[model samples]
Target: MKKRNLFLFYIVVILFFTGCVSLKDVSVYKNEEISEYKYALINSTESLTSNVGTTINGVYVSEGKTVNPRDIISGYLMKRGFIIITEISDDIKDKTLIVNYGESGRRNILFGYTTEVTLQFISAGTKNLVCSSTAEGIGDREADDIKKAITRALEAVFEE
Candidate 1:
């Protein structure tokens, strides 16, 4: 009886761990026709460096309180071979996301820091997709997170 119970426990653990790799959240958007959408990026880089290898300064500005939805949709449509009509409904294909970065650190330690990038995407169209990624480090985690979020968002748009 003990051996059988152990085997059942192992099976449950395997199933739990394996579920993480499945892209179930993205599957809901498979049938949605997303020729284009808006692109608004609110980057909170207080936890990491901004443009590590670039000479630009203060590119990481304060988080904007309000992001124009139309502007983002127009920009996204323009970049992805789609035309943005003024008639586009705010009801459908409305993509808005808030990105934040958080960090915890320990002083006097060799390399002690924890950081994460949180992404929240909301769309009213048939595309019901949401995604996020987090990286912990003292280096370029902010930039990495931005890259990862964008990649995930795009992939979500095209996921089957």
Candidate 2:
């Protein structure tokens, strides 16, 4: 029994180690010029209205309070030497007024709505070149989606 248990343990350990080395080394390389180029995120179109609250996808969301693309891109540029310039559309206010005649001639209903934020990547800057990339998002856009767009835009500029 003891011998059988020891044998099984050894087999399991060997299998685990082998599974870890699935990828083999390759001789692929990137051009030095491309590797050294930098990128940055300068601006985003997201905005926060001074008073009213907003929600995205049914969930309450906050700006200048929650998070924004500019913040993430700025951080990414700091480490990668990339610059991202962002532009946002004018803040739009959506008013939803409801008028209801309640019991005892009482009136119920007021204004209800949320704001929409659209952000565009707009521009990017390198040591010798500047280019524009458009990335726009409406009301409560996903953070990951914005990040992905920013990344793709940066990659495109670097390739050019």
Compared with the true structure, model 2 gives a TM-score of 0.29
**Residue 152 error for model 1, in Å?**
2.2
Report the poorest 10 consecutive residues by lDDT, candidate 2: 93-102
Off by over 4 Å in 2: 1-41, 44-66, 82-129, 135-141
lDDT of 2 by residue, 66-156 (tens): 3455565466555655433343222311111111110111111122122212222222221232233333221222443344445444444
> On a 0 to 100 scale, what is the lDDT of residue 22 in model 2?
25
lDDT of each: 0.39, 0.36
Q: Considering only N, C-alpha and C atoms within 3 Å, which residue pairs clash in candidate 1? A: 38-72, 38-73, 39-72
* Regions more than 4 Å wrong, model 1: 1-32, 35-77, 84-139
TM-score of every candidate relative to the true structure: 0.29, 0.29
